[model samples]
Target: MMTVTDLDCLRGQRRVLSGVSFALDAGDCLILRGPNGAGKTTLLRTLAGLSPAPRGALSTAPEDLVYTGHLDAVKPQLTVAENLTFWQGIYQNAPQDTLNSFDLDELADRPAATLSAGQKRRLGLARLHVSGRKIWLLDEPTTALDADHVARFTDTLQAHCNGGGIAIISTHLDIALPQARTLNVADFAARQDRTADEEADPFLQGAY
Candidate 1:
């Protein structure tokens, strides 16, 4: 089980969302819904420990979580198989059929830089299988995927949850994951009143 209570999210010292809270048990998925700049990414970054720890509690251990952001995180020069193998080595996990898992077997030897956008997205997501973590934090995971690949990814997500994993995703698309609940992040928007000092700082202007 994972629990977050009274969480606060920030973007470069500017508070964006506050009093965020949620809990999820094994085999659960939560979808974050909000418009651009509504702090969805900030919240995910905070939960993934990429940002400073906020004024709240996260019950899950750091080692149990894996985060995937907007970028695919692929190595351009590496072949598809090599990329998965590289992550498998980093996580020190036993070998997994990652290529087959994401339907990358046909292009296993292709360099990541040569693949289409959707193929690269698949390769990026395949890293999750190699990661062997219990919790997944994804941001707009289906960015470039076509219909068929989207269905494939949906099945993959279902399989993971069925195996007692947890997923929290932020997406504008309506992905029909069974029993998944949605959280509208706009509800937690923080009200900021900038002080004179803050207003005078050129670096702070137009910061997201």
Candidate 2:
């Protein structure tokens, strides 16, 4: 389980959100919705432990959290299979046909540099299959996916939740997620003072 209490986050030296709180247990999903610059990404970054939650409580450990931001993090020179293999190794897990899951089996040998934008996005998402972490933090996950792939991704999320994993995704797309809660990030946005130098919060780290 993951928990947040009265969370306040900052971007640079300015606080972008405050008084934010939520709890996500096994098999739950939280969807973040808000306008541009409403701090959705910042909130996720804080939750993922990429940034500090200056004021609040977060319960989790780093090893249990998996975060995928706007960038794909794919190496242009690596093949699809190679990319998945690298992440699979990091998680100390064997390959689990992630390519097939994303319908990239045929393109497994192709270099990421040759893929289209949508294909590259799919490759980025495929990393989810390799991560054995319990908590997922995804930003704009469905950006370049087609309707069919979106549907597949929804099914994947449902399966993950059913297996007792929790996910928080920020997206504008309409996708069905089991037991999903919608959170409008704007509701948590607030302005506050912050010092130029501050250490990151350790409470937000995920469990192994």
Q: Which candidate is the best by TM-score?
A: 1
Error of 2 at 169 (Å): 0.8
What TM-scores do the predictions have?
A: 0.92, 0.89
- Give all candidates' CA lDDT scores: 0.91, 0.85
Candidate 2: where is the Cα deviation over 4 Å?
192-208
Residue-level lDDT tens digits of model 2 in 54-139: 79988989888888988998999999989988888888876566777788999999999999988998999888778888898899
Estimate the overall C-alpha local distance difference test score of candidate 1.
Answer: 0.91
For residues 86-192, could you state the per-residue lDDT of candidate 1 as single tens digits? 89899888545778878999999999999999999999999888899999999999999998898989999998999999999999988788779999999999888
Off by over 4 Å in 1: 196-208
Looking at model 2, residue 51 earns an lDDT score of 92
